[model samples]
Target: MGLIITFLAAAFLIAGVVRGSFVNKRANEELPFPTPVSQEVEGSTDDRDVPYYDDDKEEDEVIETITPFIPTPTVSDSQTSDSSATNAYIYPNSTVLSTTANSIELSSTSDPGDITNWYKKLFEEKHFKARSFAQTNTNGHVLNKLAGAGGSLDLEVEIEKKPNEKITVIKVTY
Candidate 1:
């Protein structure tokens, strides 16, 4: 009786295991398979039917066909002509050694007795002839009567003359 009971219990356990495995297999096989949509089908269904464009478009499509990257040549200051017709004059003995946008450099062979005389000649030559000399120092001289009589009389001077060789470097600003 004991042997029969044990055999019956073992058979019942095997039957339950077999039934559970069969049901699991059937459920796996009957599962609804997901359908894969092709690229063409997905694109056609989209609201924007046009194909997606990457950065790999043709040269013509990627760049503007009409206008290309054209480099423009630059014009230099030497090539441009002076627009103003007004002319300036330098004394026959005097020559403009160099010039800049802000100042004019002049050299002369005349004897500048003192800073006062040197400043006077410089002022007169620069169209400040109507003005009078004001003061003088070891460095430079000043003009008392302004060129624009009532306005400002701003001047700066630098001398680079050797005793034997007569030359002067006068810098003026107004």
Candidate 2:
């Protein structure tokens, strides 16, 4: 039994030494050798022989042929005239409350209902208050009305004209 064990140990040691020597010799080659070409490269033809950019000029010509069209915004006098007419109707009896491209200010002796009634009569759509109306007594009149009771009574309404150039309706709650 002792002899068999000793023989097996000697065999393993010899195998290990052989493997280590083989690896070391392979890793320590002295030649500064060039890398071997892969099989794909060895069998390939010259790339320049075929036209790689054959479609490049054609592609540029195609792009040039496509002229980009940018449409300009045309403001018709009729539209402006219509907008002014609508504006005039919105604050017929009221004082020049405030006026801007996007907003209007009016001071009137009438109640909030009167203001709403005017809007309802002029525009097909309903206009509601965006925020509480702030109450101010400018010459004995409520300046702006918020949408509902206890909301601001003084109103600064934001009016937006839709892309179709039609007026968008807003309601004030006060």
User: Of the candidates shown, which would achieve the greatest TM-score relative to the real structure?
Assistant: 1
Give the clash total for candidate 1. 0
TM-score of 2: 0.27
CA-lDDT, candidates in order? 0.49, 0.46
Query: Model 1, 134: alpha-carbon shift in Å?
Result: 4.1
Q: What does candidate 1 score on TM?
A: 0.31
For candidate 1, the 10 contiguous residues with the lowest summed lDDT are 142-151
The local lDDT score (0 to 100) that residue 136 gets in candidate 2 is 47
Top model number, lDDT: 1
**C-alpha RMSD for every candidate:** 26.4, 20.9
For model 1, the stretches where C-alpha displacement exceeds 4 angstroms are 1-62, 65-89, 113-162
Could you tell me how far off, in angstroms, the CA of residue 92 lies in candidate 2 after the best superposition? 2.4
lDDT of 1 by residue, 1-174 (tens): 999999999999999999999999967864333343323445355655444444333343232257778999987865543424111323345677766554456666654445435455656655542464433333443222222221233344443454444564443333
